[model samples]
Target: MGGVVERTDLGRGDDPLIGRVLDGRYEVGQKIARGGMATVYQARDLRLDRTVAVKVMHSGLADDPEFVSRFEREARSAARLSHHNVVSVFDQGDDRGTLFLVMEYVPGLTLRDLIRKDAPMDPGKALELIEPVLAALAAAHGAGMIHRDVKPENVLLADDGRIKVADFGLARAVNAETQHTATGGVLIGTVSYLSPELVVDGKADARSDVYAVGVLLYEMLTGVKPHQADSPIQVAYKHVHEDVPAPSLREPALPAYVDALVARATARDRDLRPSDARVLLHQVRRVRQALDHGVVEDPELYADLMPGVRPIAEDTGEVTGELEREDRISILGADDVYDQDREVTTAMPPSGVATAVPPRPPQNLAHNQPPRVVPPPVVADEPRRFQQPKRSRRGLFLLIGVLVTALLVGISAWQLGRYTTTPSVISLSQSAAKAKITKAGLTFKLGKAEYSEKYTKGSVMDTDPAPGDKVSKGGTVTVILSLGPERHAVPTVRGKTLEEVQQLIADADLSLGEVTQAYSDLVDEGMVVTTDPKAGTLLKRDTAIDVVVSKGPKPIDITDWTGKSAKQAQKSLEKQGFKVTVDEQFDDTITKGKVISQTPNTGQGVKGDEITLVVSKGPELFAIPHVRGLRTNDARQKLEDAGFKVKVHHSSLFVGANYVVTVSPGEGTMVPKGTTVTINVV
Candidate 1:
């Protein structure tokens, strides 16, 4: 796949491996791009006679055996995928000390470059670009792999207008053991594309990739990330706690269904999102269909795409009943009592007013024991039933009395058993505390946790009811967990830049307490030398992280030392921390053993800088050559070739004779280069 070239300090020719062959198969060519993990170079597959791209890992990472193994494994896994939208991985091998991967070389720019040039793309175009990316992810996910780092830079746009995805399983491999941080402690994936679950718990699955794609779609349609903040931490927090605003909020021209699609895919709760890339791909197609149909308001489609609203559980009905009972008890005054006898009497008919009662004669005399009685008459065709009716009414009244007594008793029993004292769960682990609460027939709730030195992290520090406080059965018991000691480990920041050190301090929840400067030969200037407490020291949060920075190698100024003895000059330069190399030569003017010249005659250099000194070895000397029998031209040519400045001298009378009498410095002599030689011709 053609990846977007990330801007970096390195140029195309910066990599030393360029133009070198790896494994005697792939010949590395010009660098195509450089990223945090590796440098991509255009290469030639010599055996296959085809062009390929070779990605060479950085030395620092390749040195780690674990990381290298993981990298190789992931490369193999990615190679197994045969989707057309995926960049093909052909080979992986280590050459000498360098580890590299040979992949298909696509000829084009990256999605990142496209976004920079033409963004806020039309809805149709945005969907078109995202569809293929989803398909590639779908294939990877189907193989039980995840592209943890999904961003525009990994999405490639080929010259032929084909879209492809790169670096399929690399992020997962890197992030396997721990949260992978690139140089300067920035996360491996782009912060803008990080999912909420990844930010909060450092966990990711297929849904996390879906969330990233949703963010991608939003950026493509709106020209900006859905969540924006001053720092990555803040942006990550927003992703955890806030829902991504609809795209229409930024670009009102976007249809509502598009916003709904983004929302569903990026929902903070993984359960509410599409389960995997395939499901999200299906949703993408539906949205595309809506856009193609030119539907203005597709509420039905929007609803279908929206996350399912969770329904209240049936167990909540018990809670509602308890609440209602409590409300009724509070409303009813305890002092209020009813007069049962008066109530019964008020409900019954008056004896004197009732004409249906049986007729009777009262006794006249107090002393008389006998009394006269009379029976009631019935209506026509009906037997006398006055006494029976009265009996029936009396039976009904008794039944009502028993029912009222039973209702009062049941209410009293419920009130008596309604509440119980909460049990102590302090200093217990979260799971144990939850089990205890559940055993007590009460619900458990996790409340805000605070740092406590007395309790370990993830343990219950306190409860709402405080132990032994009255609480109803099935009542919620909110417990505050301890975050443990409020301490953070000092992170390794040596060799990092000042800004990077500051970021590391902040990420560790520590303050940039103080910055000191010092000269370091090993560390580059403006980079960190060491921290006060060093790395991996545990201390309270916000603890000052004093850093010592490098001022680079010490600078020294060179002084003029012409005519000085070579040995003395070498000693003087060496004492001043300069590396000196002396060269002996025959000088015409300077005395023997005296310094003739020095490279970088007058300049300032750092300690340990190399300085070359040229020492004199006296004037050149040679025996005169016997050229009496030789031709004059031959003698002159031989003299000139033997490290000499030749000067031919003709005798006054023998100007035309082609014979030489003698030559100066011509035989059996060692002379300095360019020494003067005189030849006499006769």
Candidate 2:
């Protein structure tokens, strides 16, 4: 309805849309692969100039309104998931009834290819591969979404050493619309991987994904499928009725914990299995670590991972007829005992859906006789004419012991099933945390609010028993909500080193913003002088506070102010934060009040250092030697001898320049030593 719903035939013929562009962006190239309902093509994202995977739905599916609606929902769900181990969905489009989804193109083989070539792989290598798949599912589960279909076909091993899980919400779309494993009499999913719940009720959750992964793991450990039948429907029936067998049956070398891990994951009782993929992933990592360390016996790990109920029969494999007749007979009861519904037939159905069916008589068995696949055929009941009187005491005793042991095991398993671990819900919203806790069959109780810097306000901060701790299914889980970060006074950073203050800031739950340098007389170099907003200021945790660090005392440069005005020198030096000292002296050639000398006038000086200046005073005055009536040359000579420059001038009258008529500065006059004197000649 939102976009074009495909109506063309892409079902069973050469695709005509090959090499054609779709949505003006994704250039659909050649078909890479095709499945029952969709065809995959290697396409190029023209806008991004990168290769991507385009999956186009078949004709019947794309044309149906119900399927199209579900398809849109699936696209939104798949696009919401983002993880390193998940194939990212980029876009969803419909171009002229051709529905397609764009996804990250992984250039590598699928897990299916790996299993086809090198199945029954080493336990370590199998775990190494499956670990990433679980991580991807875990992310989806954490986001409140489920990957309904989990199988080897969806796991891609990229050439760049990345394992990505694909096709999220695809099964959900089909399942929601069809509500069965078969659509239009065609099988949609591989029946071998379906869980008991999925096979019976067509319902699934995170545990269903875990069950499929368990089956996947078993196939890796063994080279064949665990259950075999004449038809896919029979296999689905076996999924609901039988328990998945331990891998050790195929590979005896596998540790007990490995079997326990698989058993717990694939347990028919979903409650006994891990709550979700994340919980299962944790257990897988623990087991993998143990295997890596070569631990032969880890009772604790084995106990934790082992399924509450011990199943004596049922197995999965890649190929059919993996177990012989004798093996089958020893594992389960006769087929006739499974016949509960009289209307249903055990024979393979054409529709391929798993339905409870009456057990069919084996062709190889004698006429009118039940199957002997569960136990050894001790009595060949050939319709004997006469019956022999029967039983020995030993046989009776053996039967009694078997009944008692099975009863004890059943009771113990029921008790064990009641226990499940508390899942990690830290930093999740209060409603979300409660939903998950309750979904695990546990009760929820809100506890006191606590302050935490890591968690946000009203989000889950802590749990009473803590996550990963075992609790009864109906037991109450108390959650503490975060009250946000607590406020504290800024620490004392004055006179402390940068490193020390940084540590102090962290300890106080505060972060360092910017560090500035300043010259302080009291603080040493490379030490904190003060802090922005000063010290002892109350602030929230992780708040960035600016700091001021010291670069030692300020250095003052002496400008050598000699021969400059003493008043000007003192005033200019004081303005630069340096103390000024002045001394007075008399000089013959220098100005009377100008700076005559300075002390230590060169190089660098410390802050608050004193600068000295010497002021000039007038020179001593002596009698001018009264040169009136004396020869002009004699008067000039007398004035020049006294360090004073003398100038000669004649009177207005035409008298010979023999004597000085009047002498300027005639008598004693106080002046500087370099003062000039004028004389007149008659």
| lDDT per residue (tens digit) for residues 532-588 in model 1 | 788998875555678899999878889767798888889988888888888999888
CA shift at 547, candidate 1, in angstroms? 63
C-alpha lDDT score of every prediction, in listed order = 0.72, 0.72
TM-score (C-alpha) between model 2 and the true structure: 0.48
lDDT of 1: 0.72
Cα displacement (Å) at residue 516, model 2: 35
Candidate 2: worst-modelled 10 consecutive residues by lDDT: 325-334
Residue-wise lDDT of candidate 2 within 1-682, one digit each (tens)?
A: 0111111233435668787899888888866665545777888877556688898887777896546645765676777686889997766767888888888788887787788789899989999999999999999999988777677778888899999998887766665555422333222345667777765555678998899899899989886666666544566656755667778887999999998888888887799889999999998899989999999889999888776643233322222322222111110111333322111111121222322332322322111122235554587667658779776699889999999999989998998898888887877899999999989888999998866444579998677656766688799999989877567688999988999999998787676767889999899999999987678987754456788999999887778888988888888788877888988877777878888889868988886788888888846566666777778788788878887888877678737867877767865765556677888788
List the candidate 2 regions with Cα displacement exceeding 4 Å. 1-13, 180-188, 310-355, 359-682
In order of appearance, the predictions have TM-scores of 0.44, 0.48
Flag regions of model 1 displaced more than 4 Å. 1-10, 179-187, 308-682
